[model samples]
Target: MTQIAEAVIDENGQIPLMEPLHVIGPHRALVTVLDEPPAGWDETLMAAEKALADDWLRPEEDEAWAHLQ
Candidate 1:
């Protein structure tokens, strides 16, 4: 069986698991480090809002979604 989890690496090169592992005994695992920190809820919302800030106000865009309104 395979399992996945997220962890943060400490300054001393230690990774602390956010949750306890379900499997027991020795097992091989793969680790990948992201280039940038993961975005939280606020960051995601802000990015989406910024991307569509004036989209609805544009004439072409408004017409495209007119049928749904």
Candidate 2:
């Protein structure tokens, strides 16, 4: 299994879904992310913050969290 795909929550307080994604085409896909994932999501999020540092993601996308490389 892979780790979580990171995203930031929008002003609406919603994050982007990351997994179970299916691409219908270049412009469309389905994805999922747990607001509170089981086990170590908190730790994962923290680690992601450290990983991100001063980098900037697309704020318009509402990327409160970001997927770490």
Candidate 3:
């Protein structure tokens, strides 16, 4: 049986499982660390901020799209 759980490691290099194992006495497990955010996070935010900074609703732009409004 395979089980997956998320845990944080303490300063003493120990991670406490949130739940008990169903299988009996001794078992082997694998631990992986996910310490970084997803890729392109900063770039996505910067692009969004740049888009908001543009004058998309200016008088000229508004008139151009007045039919839609």
Candidate 4:
């Protein structure tokens, strides 16, 4: 299994993790430095809303979930 943890790299090369990484033993890891700030949840969802609406608006999609209603 693979484990992922978010962290911030400092100017002096220090990394402070945002959360605990549960795992055993030592292992090598990869670090990607993003130049741009990550997008907000609202922006991320709205960006996909149009694409997803293409399928979600279909009558078949509503029928599939009609049982729940």
The most accurate candidate by TM-score is 1
Q: Write the per-residue lDDT of candidate 4 for residues 1-69, one digit (tens) a residue.
A: 778887767679898888998778998888888776444747988889999999799999999999999
Worst 10 residues of 3 by lDDT: 33-42
lDDT of 2 by residue, 1-69 (tens): 233455655579676654654445455333555566556668888988965764654573345554632
List candidate 2 stretches off by more than 4 Å. 1-36, 57-69
TM-score of each: 0.52, 0.27, 0.43, 0.47
Instruction: Report the number of backbone clashes for model 1.
Output: 0
lDDT of 3 at 35: 77
Candidate 2 — which pairs collide?
6-67, 7-65, 8-63, 8-64, 8-65, 9-64, 18-32
- Candidate 2 versus the native: TM-score? 0.27
Can you list the residue pairs that collide in candidate 1? none
Give me the runs in candidate 3 sitting further than 4 Å from their true place: 37-69
Candidate 3: deviation at residue 18, Å? Answer: 2.3
Scored against the true structure, residue 26 in model 2 reaches a CA lDDT of 58
Off by over 4 Å in 1: 38-69
Instruction: Give the Cα error of residue 23 in candidate 3, in Å.
Output: 1.9
Residue 10 lDDT (model 2): 59
lDDT score for candidate 3 against the true structure:
0.76
